[model samples]
Every structure is written in structure tokens, then in C-alpha cells.
Target: MPRYEYRCRSCGDTFELSRPMSESAAPAECPAGHADTVKLLSTVAVGGSSSAPAPSSGGGCCGGGCCG
Candidate 1:
């Protein structure tokens, strides 16, 4: 389940709800029972290491000083 943030325009309240991604666009009722609400843009944080290899310090013409 993904969490979605919403803001209630009627009561000026912000809240979050956990639901399926398929119904993410569905309207949500605020905790104050306000029907006039709009979904907010949420930022997602992805955690993991990058697959790209690190730069080598002892390779290439630059490292070997062959260009000069």
C-alpha cells in the first residue's frame, strides 16, 4: 500500500491515507469530514546504492600522465 497526502480546502486541513495505487486518484474525505479536498503532490524517497561503477584512480591516460 502507498501513502497519499491530501489537503482539505473546506477546513484547511492536511492528512494522509494509505491505499492502493489504482485508487490514488480517488477522492478522499478529510478527518474533519470535509468533502472539498485535493490530493497533494508527494515526494518519494528511494533507498539503495547506485549500480554504476566508481571512477578508477589508476587508469586512463590522465591517471598515467601520458597526455603530457
Candidate 2:
């Protein structure tokens, strides 16, 4: 299940709901029983250690003066 954020225009309230992706676009009622609501764009945060090796400081042939 994915969580979605919504804002109620009637009461100016913000809420979140967890539902299937199939119903993500379905209308949601606010906790205050307001049907006039709109779904808000969600932001995702990703964090992790990269597996790729870092670039070498000793730049390649150019830095080694081999290109000249």
C-alpha cells in the first residue's frame, strides 16, 4: 500500500491515507467529513550508500602529461 496526502478545501484541513495504487486517483473524504478535497503531490526521499567506486584524484592521461 502507498500513502497519499490530501487537502480538504472545505475545512482547509490536510490528511493522509494509505491505499492501493489502483485507487490512488479516487476521491477521498477528509476526517472532518468534507468531500471537497484534492490530492496533493507527494515527495519521495532516497538515501543510501553508492556502490560505485569514487573517481581517482590522479586524473587520467591528461593529468599525467601523456596527451602532449
Candidate 3:
């Protein structure tokens, strides 16, 4: 089973569920009993080294931000 995050449009509530991969795309019922829920895009981080370099400051035009 994998953990999936869902957001309910009716009550504006967020929750998590553990279900089979085959049902990953299936609709989830909110804990508040709302059926109008959709799965949320989740962020996953994978790392094995504590000495990993920190993320850059994301400065300049290289990033989406302008270099103003």
C-alpha cells in the first residue's frame, strides 16, 4: 500500500490514505464524508547522504525570477 494525499473540494479538507497502486487514480472520500475529493500532487525526496549540498538560492534569470 502507498500513501496518497487528497483534498476535498466540498469542505476544503485535506487527508491521506493508504491504498493499492491499482486504485491510485481512484476517487477518495474525505473523512468529513465529502465525495468531491481529488488527489493532490505530492512531493517526494530521496536522499542517502547527510552531507548532500543544500539547494541553491535560486537567484537570477537562470531561475524563473528576474535578475532585477
Candidate 4:
């Protein structure tokens, strides 16, 4: 099952649900039984710094910031 993020407009509650990918969204009813709700796009993110040597700068480095 995949996780879907949801926000309750009625109670202003944010939550996550684990359901089948086909579920599409969770019930509008909030945990508190509020009917006004909406499914939200989760903003999951990953953070890391790659030290594997930066790729060569396009156009090659020159005395000016913009060089070709």
C-alpha cells in the first residue's frame, strides 16, 4: 500500500493514510468525523550533497561568468 497525504478543510487537520494505490484518496471524513476534507499532494523530499565531482560547467570556465 502507498501513503497518501490529506488535509481536512473543516478541522484543518493534516494526516497521512496508507492505502492501496487505487484508493485515489481517503474518505473526506476526518478522524474526528468532519465531512469537509480534501486529499493533498505529499511534499516528501530527500536531501543529500553529492561530492562525486561536479560535472564540467557548460561552455567551459572562462574569465567571465558567461563564457562559451
Clashes of each: 0, 0, 0, 0
List of clashing residue pairs for candidate 1: none
Candidate 2: tens digits of C-alpha lDDT, residues 1-68: 89999999999999999999999999999999989999988655233457777756768668756788
The lDDT of each candidate is 0.87, 0.88, 0.85, 0.71
Clashing pairs in 3: none
lDDT of 3 by residue, 19-38 (tens): 99899999899998999999
Candidates in order: C-alpha RMSD to true structure:
7.0, 8.2, 10.5, 7.9
Q: State which candidate has the highest TM-score.
A: 2
Runs of candidate 3 with Cα error greater than 4 angstroms are 45-68
Model 1 residue runs over 4 Å out of place are: 45-68
Query: How displaced is residue 58 in candidate 3, in Å?
Result: 26
Whose lDDT is higher: candidate 1's or candidate 3's? Answer: 1
Q: What is the lDDT of candidate 2?
A: 0.88
Q: Looking at model 4, report the run of 10 residues with the lowest lDDT sum.
A: 42-51
* Pairs that collide, model 2: none
The TM-score of candidate 1 is 0.64
TM-score of 2: 0.65
